[model samples]
Target: MGNINKRGSKDLVVDSDQSQQDSPTITVDNQLCDAIIKEDCSTIKALLRSHPVNQPLTILTSYRLLFEQQTCTVIPIHLAAEYCKPRSLLCLLEHGADPEVRDTQGHTTLHLMLLHWPIVSSTWTKPGNRIQRLMADIQNNAVSCLHILFQHGAQVNAQVGNSNKYSPLHLAITYGTHPILSLLAQNGAQVNAVNESSMTPLHMAADILNENMIKTLIACGANVNCVIPHNGNTALKLAVCTASSKAGQLLSAGVGCIRLLLIHGAHVNAQDHEGQTALHEACCGGREAIINLLLEFEANVNILTKNGESAIYMYLQRSSNIRDLMVLTRLLYCSYPLRLTNRQGVLPAGIMLPEFQLLKETLVRLARKPLPLEDICKKNIRNIYGKKYKYYVRQLLPGKLWNSIYNCYDLADVLKGDL
Candidate 1:
């Protein structure tokens, strides 16, 4: 009895090398791969009785693999999602396959489904009949796969990679439909989730001027004031700096985007890591409408960036504004600080186009004269509210005595008198 107790019939511990030698290899899972190709869940279930449900099997896909001639490493769930095989996916999930298992590219099953889906930028309108049919079929297939994965407990907010860290919400903005976005948001995907580049879905929305996406994101409690990583760019700044030229589609939407951003309490004067503000970006881009809206929200013309470049300096960089001079008139009306200079102590007149000698002289004269009393009071009120001045301006200052001055001050009329 003592001998049997001390020296057990079975070995006390399994050898590491022996376990490794006994484990199944890529070549050993040929049956699993064949079942995945046929989406034969019955065979998969039968096989899973003897093997692991989450075993890495080789399969042939159009993109990653081809046929009997080629193959790539993927678990059953990945193969199912990649092929939009919801039944196969559900089967694997039912058998306890991990829904969040990543592919070679670090994409989860949801990522595989999303990456292959086609997106037409004009989500509101349908295209030609042929394209529309194609889109509908694709949308159904992709959406079904997403629903199955979600039902199986796949992470809605699961990021793509360890280093890249792009959330599913970010991908949905580009490749996903409103249903996918809604599903993710409803299932607790962080609306404000930041990627490795410190970009949020709101930033992408602003870049593309997707008004619907912007409104939806903000309604879901997105931070309009959130900035990017290195450059620290806010959504409003990105909106002002929108550089898209898609048949002028995105260009005309600039005013609407800035309006939405400003109305929702985006800081008009929110500075970047380099201390540049949205007004500066608008000025640089020569965006008259955007600049006007920024000024209406009380963007400080006197705010100098880290390089000591004021809005006046930025406005002059665009050659198109030279003939118009409307920007100069607006700057004067908004009480752009007169004596503010660049890093080298250079005033606007110092680099002023010789063609506008008359305006240069006027600028010099304005610098000598004191700012108007009304302008002084307005500046003081704005300063009191600091960065959060937009709310108070709409509520308090537009009261009894100065309502006309606050709300209806004529820009052209005021500039004519000053000049």
Candidate 2:
């Protein structure tokens, strides 16, 4: 194949040795595209070098490529990235192939690299050796391609994609590319860059309950309390919402992420657009561990949503399991107000079904009997000190006094009901 020349206003022709009758003239763009699909590094290099300086290379015309019977518009670099052909990608980049060039959908080569990575799901019953090897190769090539692009002065924080305008860091977090996330952060990728949905990389990590990614983002200076612009939902809110449907391994990881966020100063009582806090979301999830964690952080159980629904009210409406009932019991012991009414004028106690007769009776009794004065004082003290009270108390008090307060068995005993 030789240089591309305009045969007519509408057609591009590639000069070749074969006669026109023997091998009909093919479009020059098609010739280069075929080389890209086949990963012909030598052919690509020849075409780039021998192409006329005045004409320049219109490689963008060959954006569309067929993969697994699906047609997607992709530049040569993106195609190379997808196929894990690092040699071809580097050759194209050296030849002026823009690493920042976006496809029709505004996705850069970096976005395609993360998007096409082979994700091995837990549900796969049997992954053959070929599949495993293929996955490993893909991962290796992806890392190499990323490094090459960065070295070539690719914008680390360039937001691509038509829908969300996601930065490379966002894609890394979304695709579970742990190493890539770290690389991007270390290379000056904006840790707090919000996507089209106002979600930062931290929000994405928290949404998936990825503890390691969360830690990485936080260490890179992610704002722990940064709320999504539209929903005003923080990373803590996203974590609680995600933990609801997760189970077993994912649930444990979710719990850990929440704990990590809280320890890093995530506000427990931060409300969303509807005035619902992390406690409200946890209650809606009906997970005992999450609810207990938020309660221990002193999430105001009596806090109301825009609709006047409290956390306990939402819990009652969403969950009916015995475990959830026990969670409600714990909330009651924590002094969640029993007399709160929602916007619809429905009280939490009045809506209790007959199956929860014991709970209903207990709530009635608690409503009539005043909480212990000492317990009320302790609750107030905790509220004043905030969740990091223990650390402050330790720093302010002597070891013996601190131990005495820390080992307050009566406080623990009162919180733990005999039932």
Candidate 2 global CA lDDT score? 0.68
In Å, residue 316's CA in model 1 sits off its true spot by 1.8
- Off-target runs (Cα >4 Å) in candidate 1 are 1-40, 43-52, 60-69, 120-131, 243-250, 348-351, 371-419
Candidate 2: regions farther than 4 A off: 1-40, 50-74, 118-134, 246-253, 318-326, 349-351, 368-375, 378-419
In candidate 1, list every pair of residues with a backbone clash. 61-65
Which pairs of residues have clashing backbones in candidate 2? none
lDDT of 1 by residue, 1-419 (tens): 00111111111122233434443653345566557646788888888887687877643323213222334556777766665666677888888888888876788888767765545445436545665766555556667878887777889888998686889988878765555667778778899998888899999888877777888888888999998879989998887788323322344667787789889999888899888988887777665666777877778877888988888777765545544356666565455465446788776543366665655566667667787787777656544443345456566554664443444346444444433
**Candidate 1 lDDT score at position 133:** 63
Candidate 2's TM-score reads: 0.74
Per-residue error for 368 in candidate 1, Å, reads 2.7
The 10 consecutive residues of candidate 1 with the worst lDDT sum are 1-10
